[model samples]
Target chain A: MSTRPLALLLLALACTLRPAEDHVRLDERVGRAETPDTLVLEEDGLAAIREATPRGARLWAASPVLHLRLRTAGGPFELVVRNTLRDATLTLDDGTVIEREPGGLPTEARFVLDLPAGVERTARLAPPDADAAGSFHVAVLSDVQDAIGEVQDIYERMRADPSLRFVVSTGDLTDSGTRAQLVRFQEELETLPIPLYSTVGNHEVPGPEAWHDLFGPFNAFFRFRGVAFSLVDSSTATVDPALRRERLRPWLEAHRDAPHLFLTHVPILDASGLRSGAFRSRNEAASLLQELADAEVDALFFGHVHSYYAYSLAGIESYIAGGGGAIEEELDGIGRHYLRVEVDGARGVLGVGLVRVD
Target chain B: MTRRHGRRAQVTAHLLLALVAAGLPAARVAAQAPRTDPSADAPAEPPPPEAEPPRCSRARRRAAPALALTAGLLLHGTGHLLACERRTGRRLLAAEGLGFGALVLGGGGIALTGASRKTVAPFATLAILGVGTFAASWLADLYGTLSGGANAGRPARAAPFELALGYRYVHDPQFAYGHGLHLAAEGWLHRTRLFGGAWLALDDDTQRATAGLSQRLLGARGRGDALDAEAALHGQRFGTDGFRTLGVDVLLRGRLELAHLGPTLAGSFVEAEVGLGLQGFGYDATGRGVREDWNGLLLGRVGWGVFLGPSGELVAYYDHRRDDLAGGLSVDSVASGVLGHFGLAGRGYIRDGRWGLAGELELGSALVVGLSVLHRGAAPREGGAR
Candidate 1:
């Protein structure tokens, strides 16, 4: 009779002590800005970040900071800044308050907004706007986590292909949702010669709100070659219902006929976008996939179980790109591989291939 | 649940922040030094970075090695139990010798597993492997017992093979002999831990035989026999170290045998053991042996030990046996010992798939030791940590 409580107490103590080794903290610097580099914006410095980008750059609306890889006639320098909704007027040291266009940047022959004198700012070209003429193809990689070497190899090979445009990641970039894991994921992504646009996956969202707050608008969308590339957050688990039928269904339907692909962290069914599984529940996943299928979506890409599975259900080709990440479960006989798509005017044909850097 | 999750999140965030902050000083130090390109070195270079020397106060550095030694010693108390059977002759000693050899070579596996920078993957693997080895050793013991003396030294021939080797020895003026070697292998068959092995022995007297069989049992703890032949009852008392076992071995064994015991002794023994325990000993029909005039032996088993793994535990057990001699002379010797075991094991994907490692230590008057590595399921070519 007395043993029960003692056992409970021991269990409680064990549980508390279990995670100590994992909680090792080596130092104390985070969130605090260091050094006044023209590239590194201190708090909410929109002008500095923009000054770092080209004159007419169309940026992600919710992006908090603009990362600039400064390239001069001499060499290259790197800069970064926190750009919020607030606008800022870029002025040279000689009082040149450059007349900047208000919204929707123009594409060709964009001016290089030189930094204030005495402040050596590195300049990098931002992604060209959708209005730019030529259509390009993005890899749309998803869920590339701990398998750093393999993912890096894939990135390098993709970089070598001139036909390939910038890369788009459909989130779940880490396995344990740890900062180190996220950082390593970012480090691997940084090796790409082209730019990368990413959306959050279920694994990326440590909590419903915390990670979203840290990485804003994790569930959002963008346009490439006038085609709608929606980064919809289909994860109903461990998150708030920012994805409502009234919000997503109509938007998806509106862009259904467009030459577009839906990029998400969950899979959708053919009938409805409602997730349902006894052992593994994707209640919202079912609804999303169903909606895509009903809409005749071209391609659906996602990852979760670290497997490579492709299903052509209801006229939609669904590909699981989880092989780029940790293989927690069996890879379902598909050794780690990546997808390279050729997107012309309309049809997007994906070719799965090996990344030979090992 | 929310609170727990919140706490977990908060703790994770704080810890991450702290790690980044701590790394800052080093980053700053690096910044201060020459900005050497990390990629300048080749990838195949044997360890890109040496383990940082303990850089603390003199007292701290001194304390670090002491702490490490203390931890090693503490873990040592839970070393491998290579011999868990009675010192039937000298088999237990030989098994211990092999176990020691494995320990020296085996510690490298633990070091390599521990040295991995990936946090979750390595420790998770270690914990799993440790737990698994602990379980495997126990299971092997049970399987060996169930299969009887016939299946003693052969390893299971299948995918994900696991192996164990043990030797024991005892020397006394009266007995003057005891030594045996045992080897067993296990593998996955329809998701069940199935195994087989062979055992060999050379005693001081001149009794030698080779036996082997295969068995399948619940993970590491099971009772019963492969085939039931005789039904007899017997009780016995056995003591070793600081323990004693008083129980009856209810056995029914009917088989053939061939032996040449020189001119004085040469014959076969067929018998069955039965009864409630050692206190209650009795005999029944179905009996034959070289010492026809004398009766059999009553036996009990007792052993205890501490395990070194996460589930490290102190286990003790007792058993008794009786054998009827054909001649007037009857010999009954009690055997007992303590065993301590430490282990590390886990399941994960290496080279992008599933793999696992298991290791254990057994120590006592009678000891047995084993180590096994396994990989199963399809592996993703890409590798990672979770």
Candidate 2:
């Protein structure tokens, strides 16, 4: 069959994106963007009451900060930090303590910020006594496709481990990428103690405008301590070589010298060697694997397989940890688990510990 | 891709450490250790040798006949009868060619009717005819091949026409009661065979016709019994019990003989079937389509078949289909697979959504207690050279 018409139809659909509305509903909270930089946080039509950051911390001056974009505007702004978080310490660039209200659920850390516009601002919320260096843990999860019923136990298990800094997933957040499904997943995620960062999966699908509003970007990269975590949106089950060369190459090049990890929804090369399981073309997979090899990436993480498999691809340590509450592959011995990867700032990946529900 | 079978990772790690400590060449050690290790959770066992395939005495005997069936398909449906009847082989080949030609012609018609739904029926009809003919020809060639077995002493006796009779009871929600006398026949077309059956209502006037064609492809020995491959096409018209349903399926399946499983399973075999085709409804007198509405369908079935000596065979299976064909008699309603129905109460027998469990026995080769059948492994060898 000729593919021209189908391609054109997809192209036409991609061109039309729904405009954003005034209010954005995030998990349980609904709020409007107060300014281009700040967001006002409220619940149940409650007055926007915020606590101030202790006098010592000179960073964010508000109680709890929804989001603080660095100096986007001249501000004698007030940051409203949510009181729900347990004993939390907020910090900014240059080692400045932004908020330290002790570990209490009720006390809000309202801080008054006097900042000049037009500079970069990067601050992170970490537990009060977390080590500034050495080993850190990242929980890897994926394929929670409406297996919402069984996922609560998974979250509870994760909550029991305080050492896991953040949860990262190679997405399948919903069975079908619908707004309601996405919201439901978020509601379930709220039970987790930390945030989860994810790249979309084929199940999440492309062309869902809510994808952008829910997740950050199609492709994203961020560094923690010295390790670069790069995510390329290979959600279509096939990674076109041109896309790999153009978009993914730059990120690989920039992070080549650092301890780097790659994450995507579909495995670039299925270790199973089943043509039915992997990408459409072997050449594409080969090209992407070659690129990862050249960059000397430390480890590759993938989901889609709905089973846990550990192997090496193009000399890089790769793991498929799709044990998140989805239907287990036939004869794969169903087990719900996530990979707890410990990364050292000076060294590369220390070890990957498979923590299971049992 | 080699399927490594143990704590290969731990072994490899130890090997590398030992080599490093002993100042041995890393390349040599690396070459000895396989790169592809099976899933870590997989049970460990010694890897098979890289020599000739392991086989049993029975498998060695059936190799010749299995090869002949393979040759038939490779020879465009002529090889099966080549060792038996030259004229039959030539006719089977001719039928195969005609069917293939019809399929291509239908494909061309579809191209001509591109974006024009008005002319699809003609092409659709041609395509259906092509597949039907293909199935008939293959079944014909297979029967000639089945009779050409190396174990001629134990081979099934050929009858010009075979008749079978049986009885069955079905507890379907749509039909309060369904049980009747089942009668079926197998008629030979030259060397090929076609099967047709009907279940007459003993109590109610709900009658249905079951028709199908099947052919063996090849086989190879596994352990003590043979593994085989078969291609089949079947259709059912369900006006029985006031359910007007018509469904046709085509499958290319593989099976293993009962003995290969264990000494106790000497007369039964297991099979897995994957099929995709079209199905729809509406039937009239003459047991053919009156007005049809077709939709693409996907299906999978895993079954167990037991040879009841000369009494034919009995097959029990669990089927999964993307469509709910039997008036939604089974509907799990979840937009998910097997695990999705979790937490739901009482998702019964034929999983309502896309899964069903059924069992039936064929009375001789002529009568069937159910619409489905699990092809048997006739050869001593299993399918493939493996």
Candidate 3:
């Protein structure tokens, strides 16, 4: 009896685990407070996270460089970097080495340089892009949770499309909501030429704190140019009817006139409705579709169905862009791919193009 | 007696409330067809009181029990295990008693006249005794009818086809979303009832399906009176998860009636069932080789059902199974009174995982609602009473 109790205690402790520690983090001191977007890191600079941690992964190097949105026409700007010794030599894209100034703080390498705005560059110290929100070309991706190891091809594909501004994903960035999966996912994401904004999927439901630590929130609203995007939580089917009358209805009503796009991990109804593999309640799904139609939402994108499908329901254009390096479905006849959505400031959505990577 | 009557009243009340809530209103699918001929639809014209048969001679009234036995033995009438009342009892008793008594004499006489002494007397005697027992039971039924009780008549026959739709929430932390839609259909051909269904996640790319058949070898059409043998096949798909399953199941079920006194469980009953099955599946994650395996499992269940009038049933059951069906590849699901005709339903095996709190009403005829929904007894393509 006593032994059984002891075994249960240990089991409980094993399940409620803390985030794993990264063995590859640089121990060198750094200046300024590190965040997620500051330093430019190569593959070597990205620390591989330990597996099975409760909180998943996080990116920090004082601040890893995610994007350089240059707004000035042309001017001198300071670049910050970490994990270095002495005054490091900074190389430009053309292979020109400039001696770093013994600047700001001794813990980091800060370089002040002049560059033209509106131009994108990749270098040893400042792989960069200018702020160009005027052309909103986003790559929609999802369901790459356990397959981050195979995502390098996807990243390369995005880099090839310099016109693609960034990535917007619905969820499933990891397989088991583990720290290692998140870290690996983040590491692979850094390979892309642009940053990624995403809302958590069911796989990210391990705990809200861990998700908040990495991605801002499970549901969010952000706008670019003249179009708006809303990412809502459909992670749990059979949502309370009141949720519609409360949060969702008001939000949709507020943005009724704006060209808007909705993002979720699940669809209101599967195109293969015959299989009944869609929402829990036809009543609820029909209501959601009606609401979207009433709001005249531009498009709704989802990613739980590991396949590429495009269809319209209740007059709303919808697509399931789930081919994100996870297991491929032969029936879908499409290889691993992402949807490239072109948006014009004045005209709203132009078209959705399939970019196959595998 | 009063306790049982009160339960019947309570069950009737709940049944009515459930019926109204189950979408039975002006929006009903169709009006039920009348069962009787045109004249029967109107109130019966009263006959002169002088036409009433003289109350069974007081002496014959006391002999009603014996007469019931004699009539029932011949397979003719009924025996009223009666509770004397101020009125109506004897009227019902007379209908059952005299009717059955006539049949016993008639059917028995035919049996005797159809053969010679050696075969005739034995056959006649056997026929009389058999019919007598039948009549006794019929008379008891007459008593129940006079009581204006539910479950007063034989239960509705299982239609050739059944369709059900509902919602479910799974508690598998390893899986994607937890809630989804459920759709099922079953057909009857003689002794066999064939069924199939699917469960799909509302948000995630998860889906499961199953098909099966159950044959009632003996007993039926009433609560606590049944025996059945069943078999089935199952399949499922979790998109991108690279998981699938195929399986077989077999089982036997039996039940017994303890009392025929009231509607619902106010009438006592008992049931027992046992089953065994085998499941096989293929699973592959990452670049790992396709892994295949077969597993065998055991299951047991016991429950009781209450027949609540023209239609409707309330059942309570406890079930136990040794393993998860199809290694999580196939979802084993059901609608209506969890046991297919009773109350409660739930799926899972986390010690506290399996449970179902359900209620059904035969509204506009039959539609189970609350937590789950099941449209019962409408034959395929043909309109049957709801």
Top candidate when judged by TM-score against the true structure:
2
Strongest candidate by DockQ: 2
Best by lDDT: 2
Error of 1 at B383 (Å): 60
Q: Candidate 1: where is the Cα deviation over 4 Å?
A: A1-129, A132-135, A149-151, A207-210, A234-242, A269-279, A282-285, A328-333, A348-358, B1-386
C-alpha lDDT of candidate 3 relative to the true structure: 0.48
Per-prediction TM-score, please? 0.34, 0.42, 0.41
Q: Predictions ranked by DockQ, top down?
A: 2, 3, 1
Candidate 2 CAPRI grade: incorrect
Give one digit per residue, the lDDT tens place, for model 1 in A40-132: 332211121223322223222222223233223222322222222123223333444434344322211123354443354433222434334
| lDDT per residue (tens digit) for residues A293-335 in model 3 | 6677889898766677787655567898887865544334676
Which residues of candidate 3, in runs, are more than 4 Å off?
Answer: A1-135, A238-247, B1-386
- lDDT (Cα, 0-100) at B137 in candidate 1: 29
Cα shift from native, residue A324, model 3 (Å): 0.6
What Cα-based lDDT does every candidate model obtain? 0.34, 0.49, 0.48
Which of candidates 2 and 3 reaches a greater lDDT? 2
